[model samples]
Structures are given as structure tokens and as C-alpha cells.
Target chain A: MTATLNIGFARASLETKLFFRQRDAVIFTFSFPIILLVLFGSIFEGDLEGTGITVAQLYSAGLIGAGVMGVAFQNLAIGIAIDRDDGTLKRLAGTPMPRAAYFVGKLVSSLVLAVIEVALLLAVAVLLFDLELPTDPGRWATLVWVLTLGLAGAALLGIAVSSLPRNAKSAAAVVSMPYVLLQFISGVYIPFTELPSWLNDVAAIFPLKWMCQGLRSVFLGDAGAALELTGSYELPKVALVLGLWLVGGLVLCLATFRWTNRGEG
Target chain B: MTTAIHVRGLTKRYGEVHAVGGLDLDIRTGEVFAILGPNGAGKSTTVEILEGYRKRDAGEVSVLGVDPGQATSAWRARVGIVLQTANDAAELTVRETVRHFARYYPNSKDPDEVIATVGLSEKAGARIRQLSGGQRRRVDVALGIVGRPELVFLDEPTTGFDPEARRQFWDLIRSLAAEGTTIVLTTHYLDEAEALADRVAVIAKGRIVAEGTPHTLGGRATASARVTWADGYAETDTPTALVRTLAEKYDGEIPGLQIVRPSLEDIYLDLIGDAE
Candidate 1:
């Protein structure tokens, strides 16, 4: 077990280095969410109706959710699919490396990227948009669980969805279609207050909605609850939904994960 | 000698297509064995089954004494597989990639030594993507041997290599075989088999049509030789007699006389063609 963990850490370190080495991927992954924040945050000038918070602050908080998903889900799903297509997974499968260690490596690397992504988003939020960091220790505590649960669920789902793409060429399109749709319906692109009830129900079933709501609670505090679809932050439901995804993602990953492309078989 | 690999009645099918059908083989320890075949002749399938990457339908098989279907990590540690078309880890340097794979094995060769063995010491620090096709292939070889495996599987290991690189690769395989590593190579190049393999098996239509030493395969050593002179050429079992007759025809010196036996390639074509 110790040996496996050591290898996993080594894999993680290597994965992280490789992830950052690709300059285009690094720039696009980190900059996309920040760009969205700057674009939408700048265009929508005023505060939410009756709330003291500016529209940009709400976007700053929500884009953090999108940023995490980009780092964990989009990057991983595309990254893993590319590995599968390019024969990385197949080569590793022939080795003595523990299969579980590969997942550990992926999860650890995604977590590292997520941390850096969130920090950059927060920096953008605080510096440009005048968004306030939560003063309460409890809100900070809430941030920990939300970030943990959110990243875990997204990363695992990324691994699961990686199997859906037929090959590396189609990976980005296949992974991003649902992701872009989720951003729209999950209150990242459009606020929960403006979205219809039916859309909320659909979005509630997905982890991104709850993740966005959880982050909003951290950044927006009690006053921002007025903008929530439920008129309050449903923290327990957030935990339940994201937790369910974590388990479901693991099951799907086990079921669908393939070391080689189908054609190769 | 102990058998490094043994198989009997190995069968595999993909839906309606029989990729491997009732194939049998035995590869002995410390011998360089080559499987020669045209495309889609079950070469990759058979190797993958031995590598534990593909399931066989029906077979009694063993590799290094363990059934490959139920091979443990320790079994994997003892075997090295150099994949044919794996173009991954483009961002990683050759040294980093070799070092990373080395950690997977309990007993591993020094990364620098493996890199040098493949003649990539100058490009060790270069990222894999930056290397030429032949250089990239050398990296693949480096990764395969870094584990110091007792047995190595090379699936078309030198397909895209230039002549010089191919010769260098053959030397590497020879050195490894000298060190007592049992090597199984699959190639379309008959000369590669001739240059490296102690024994060669030609697979055609999902079965081995011929198997023997490079010289003796398909009766190549004993096949009738062609005696050629300025006037004509004749296929004869008694090439010496034919040459003597030609010498008499030339009144003591045979004009443009040559005795040529059928090449390994001719035997290979005959075997596969006959099988088809």
C-alpha cells in the first residue's frame, strides 16, 4: 500500500509538470473562466435587484465554480481521452504499476490545478470586482468541504466521461457540450433568480448547480440568499448531491474506463 | 532449455472474425524469436495475449511459468513490452519517462544506462515530441528495457527506422539477447528476422504456416539452388555439378557463373502464399 501511494505521488508530480509544460493548455485552462468573469462582470454593471451586492461579485463567485469544473472535469476528461487515444494508458497497463495508482495520480494532479485555478479566480474577484472574502471562520470552513466535495466529484466524473469520446480528436467537443450547457442552466452564465423553475430542477440534479450555490454561500453570505432559487442556501442538499455524484462517478469510472481504444481491440 | 513461453490451441475471435485460431507455439529461454507475418495475421493479437492485454478464447498458455491471463504484477515485472504505435508522453523528456517507468519494477536498470543503450544519451534531455521518428522509437526501446525484464516483446520495433537506425537497433537487440534476455520480435522485414532471430515463425491467415531457424525455415537451406551462366540458368539440387558442366562449356572457366539458393524472403512468400 505504501509503495502504491509513493508511485501515485510520483505519477501526480509528473502529471502536474506535464500539465503545466503545455503552454497553450495552461493559458486556455486558467484564462477561460477569468475571461468569462471579466467579460460578463464588466457588461452587467448594477447590483442584483434589492441585494447590496453588484452583479460582478455574483459572477466572480459563480465563475469560481466554473473554473473548478474546467480544471477538474474538462481538463481531465480531455486529458485522459488523449492518453487513451495516444496509447499512454495501454503502455501503463502492461507495466507493474498498480491500476488504482493511475487514478490517484489523476486526482492529485487535478486537485493541484484546481487549487491554483481557484486562487487565480479569487485574486481576480477580490482585486477587480471588489468581491469580499468571507470574514467568518465558519464560511471558510464551508469553503473547504465545498471545494473538496466539488473537486472530487468533478474529477471522478471527468474520468468516467473520458470513456465517452471515441478518440482524442473528439474529446474536447464531447466533454465541453454538456459542460457548456451546465454552465448556462446551473446559474454560472445565467443567475438562478432569472432562470425558470423547470431549469432549476434539471440543474439541481447535476453537481455544478450545487457547487455554484455552495461557493455563492461562501462569497455572498446571508444577504445573498435572496438570490438563491430556494430563497436560502441548501447546504445539506449541496453536500448530498455532490456526494452522490462522487459515488456515482466512481461506479461509472469502474464500469466505463478502458485502457485502450476500441478499435485497437 | 526451459521454455520462456508456451501456448497450445490458442483461439480468439472478434465477433465473426477469428483473429487467432488454434495457434501453438513454444519460445525457449534466452533465444531471440521473431514472428513474421503480413498485416492482420494475428501477430499483434498473439503478442497481446501473452502480454496479458487481450483475452484468448481457448488456450493452455504460460509465460515465464505463469498463465498470462492470470499474470500478477511480479509476472509483469519480469516482462517488457515495446508497443508499436504508442506516441504518448510527448511533453516529457526521454530521461524522465524512462525513470518514471523504472519505478514500476522492483528490479530496474539504471535509466541513464538504458537511454545510452538505445543510443539516445545525447537526446536524453530532449522531450519525446522533439525527437525524430527513429529517435522516438529508441525512447520506446529504452522504456521497455529500463525494467531489466527477463523477457521482452517487440511488436514491429523498427518499422519507421532508417537503415542506420535499424542496424543500431539490431545491435541493441543482439546485446540484450547476449545478456540472456529472451526476446520475441514481430516484423514484416524478413531481413530483420534473419539478422536477429535464432528461430522465426511465419504466420498467415491467423496461423503459423512455418517455424524454424532463419536458415532452415521452410527448407530454405536445402532447397534447390539456381546455377546461372552467360548462356542460361537452371534450378538443380546438384549446383556443383551444374557449375562444373558450365565450366566445361566455357572450356575451363565458367562465364558469368553464379550459384544462388532461394532467399529467406522467397521461402517466407512461399509459406504464406501456400497457406493462403
Candidate 2:
């Protein structure tokens, strides 16, 4: 077990280097959420009805979830598919490296990317949009758990969804379409209140909705809860739903994951 | 020598296609064994089965005293596998990649030494994507041997290499074999088997058609040699005696005389043709 963990750390370090060395992937993954925040923040102005919070601030808060999901889920799914195509998984399998070590490496690298992504989004919101940073230690605590559970669930789901693409050449399109659609329904593109009740219900079935709700509880605090569909932060429900998805994602990964592309065996 | 790999009645089928049909092989320790065959002749399938990358439908197989079908981490550490082509780790420098993989083995060679052995010392800092195809292949070889494995499997390791690169690769394999590493290589190149393998097995139709030393495969060692002179050509079992008769007739060195045995390529073609 110790050897596996040690090798996992080694793989994680190598994976991190590879992740950053791809200049195009680094620029696109880090900047996509910030670009969206800037674009939407400029278009959606004024407060929502009687709420004092500017529309830009609501977007700034919610975009954090989208950014994390982008890094943890979309990036990983596509990256793993490429790994499968390029023979990275096969090479590693031939070695003495434990299978668990591969997952550990991926999880560690995605966690690093997600943190940077979240930090960059937060920095953009604070520097350009005049968004307020939370003063309470409790809010910071909420941010940590929310980010932890949300990312774990998203990363596991990414590993499972990676098997959906027929091949690595088509992985980007296969993985991205649903992720884009999820952002719209999950209130990252538009405020959750503006969307129809049924749309919100449908979004609730996925983890993205709960993730955004959890982030809102952290960044927007009490005022943010008033605009929520439940008229509260729904912290316990957020935890419960995200927790369930985390377990469900693991099951899906076991059922669906393939070390090699289809027909390779 | 003890057997490094022993197999019998190995079979693997994909739907109606028999990818690997009842094949048996034994590779002794410290010997460079080459499995020579045409494309789609089940070379890759059989190698994959021995590498523990594919399950056999029916077979009793053992590698380094462990059943490859039930391969363990310890068993894996003792074996190295170099794939036909891999485009991964493109973003990683040669040094970084080799060093990282070295950690996976319990007793690994020095990463820098392995890199140098594969003739990549000058390009150690270069990312894999920055290297040409031949250079990238050297990186694959470096990774395969850095673990100091007792056995190494190379599946068509030099498919696209230029002649010069192939020569360098052969020298590297020679040095590895000198250190007593049992190597199993698959290639369609007859010259490659002649140059590097201690024993060559010509596989066709998912079965071994011929197996022997490079000189003896398919009765090649004792095949009739062609004796040629300025005025005539003759194929005889004893070319030395034929050359002596020609020399006496000329009262000196036979005029324009040359004796040639069947080349490995000839024997390989004959063997596979017979199997077909």
C-alpha cells in the first residue's frame, strides 16, 4: 500500500508537469471560465428584481462551480480518453504500478487544476467585478467541503464518462456537449430563479445544480439563499446529493471504465 | 537453461476469427527469441497473452515460473514490455518520463544510464513530442529496460526505423542480451532475426511453422548451396566439393567462382508459404 501511494505521488508529479506543458490546454482550461464570467457579467447588469446584489456578482459566485466542474470532469474525461488512445494506460498496465495508483495520479492532478481554476475565477470576480470576499471563517469552511465533495464527485464521473466516447479523436465533442448544456440548466449561465421550475428540478437530478447551490452559500451567504429555489442555502441537502453522486460515480466508473479502446483486446 | 516462458495449446478467438490458434512455445532463459510472422498472423495476440495484457481462451502458460494469466506485481516487475508504437508522454521530457517509470520497479537501473544506453543522452531534456519518430522509439525502449527486468518483450520494435537506426537498435539489443536478459521480439524482418535472435520461430496461420537457430531454421543450414562460375551454375548439397572440382578444372582458383547458401529471407518465405 505504501509502495502504491509512493508511485501514485510520482505519477501525480509527472501528470502535473504534462498538464502544464501543453500550452494550449493550459490556456483554454484556465481561461474559459474567466472569459465566460467576463462576457456574461458585462451583458447581465442590474439587480434581480428587488435583490440588492448586482447580476454580475451572482454570476461571479456561480461561475466558480462551473469552473471546477470544467477542470475536474470535462478535462479529465477527455484527458483519459486521449491516454487510452495513445497507449499511456497500456504502458502503465505493463509495469508494476498498481491500478489504484493511476486513479490517484489523475485525482491529484485534477485537484490541482481545479484549485487553480477556482482561484483564477475568484481572482477575476474580485479584481474586475468588485465582488465581495467572505469574512466569516465558517463560510471558508463551507467553501472547502463544497469544493472537496463537488470535485470528488465530478472527477469520478469524469472517469466513468470517459468510456462514452468511441475514441479519443471524438472525445472533446462527446464530453463537451452535455457539460455545456449542464451549465445552462444549473444556473451558471443564467440565474437559477429565472429558469422554469421544471428545468431547475431536472438540473437537481445532477450534481452541477447542488454544486452551484453550495458555492452560492459560500460566496453569496444569506442574501444569496433568498433567491434560491428552496429560499435557503440547503446546505445539508447539497451535501447529501453531492455525497450520493460521489458514491454513484464510483459505481459507474467500475462498470464502464476501459484501460484500452474498444476492440483493442 | 531453465525455461523463461513455456506455453501449450494457447487459443484466443474473437467471434468467428481465431486470432490465436493452438500454439505452443518455449523460450529458454538468457536467449534472444524472435517470433517472425506476417501481419494478422497472430504475433501480437500471442505476445499480448504472454505479457498479461490479454486473456487466453485455452492455454497453459508460464513466464519466469509464474502463470501470466494470473500475473502478479512481482511477476510484472520481472518483465518489461515495449509496444509497437506509443504516442503518450509527449509532453514529458525523456529524463522526467524515464525517472518516473523507474520508480515503479523494485530494482531499477539508473534512469540516465538507461537513457544513454538507448542513445538518447543528447536528447534527455527534449520532450517526446519534439523528437522524431526514431528518437521517440528510443524513449520507448529506454522505459522498457530501465526496470532492469529479467525478461523483455518487444513487439515489432523497429517497424519504421531507418536502416541506420535499426543498426543502432540491434547493437542495443545485443548489449542487453550480453547482460543475460531474456528478450522476446516479434518482427517481419528476416534480417533482424538473423542479426539478433538466438532462436527464431516463424509463425503463420496462428501456429509456428518453423523454429530453430538463425542458421538452421527450416533446414536452412543443410539446404543446397549454389556454386557459380563464369561458364556455369550448379546447386549441390556439398558446395565445398563442387568448388574443389571447379578449381582443379581451372588448375587454380575457380574463375569468377562464388558459393552462396539460401538467405534467411528465402527460408522464411518458404516456411510461411508452406504454412499457407
Best by TM-score: 1
lDDT of 1 by residue, B1-276 (tens): 899999999999999999999999999999999999988889889999999998899989999999999978999999999999999999999999999999999999999999999999999999999999989988988888899999999999888789998998899899999999999999989999999999999988889899999999999989999888888889999998877777776788887888899899999999888988
- Per-model TM values vs. the true structure: 0.99, 0.97
lDDT of 2 by residue, B161-256 (tens): 899989999999999999999999998888998999999998899898899999999998999999889999999999888888888899997778
Give me the displacement of residue B166 in model 2, in angstroms: 1.5
Model 2 alpha-carbon drift over 4 Å, by segment: A194-197
Per-residue alpha-carbon lDDT of candidate 2 for residues A210-256, written as tens digits (9 for 90 to 100): 99898888887787678888689889999999999999999999999
Chain A TM-scores, one per candidate?
0.98, 0.97
The worst-scoring run of ten residues by lDDT in candidate 1 chain B lies at B241-250
Tell me the TM-score of candidate 2's A chain. Answer: 0.97
- Stretches of candidate 1 exceeding 4 Å from the true structure: none
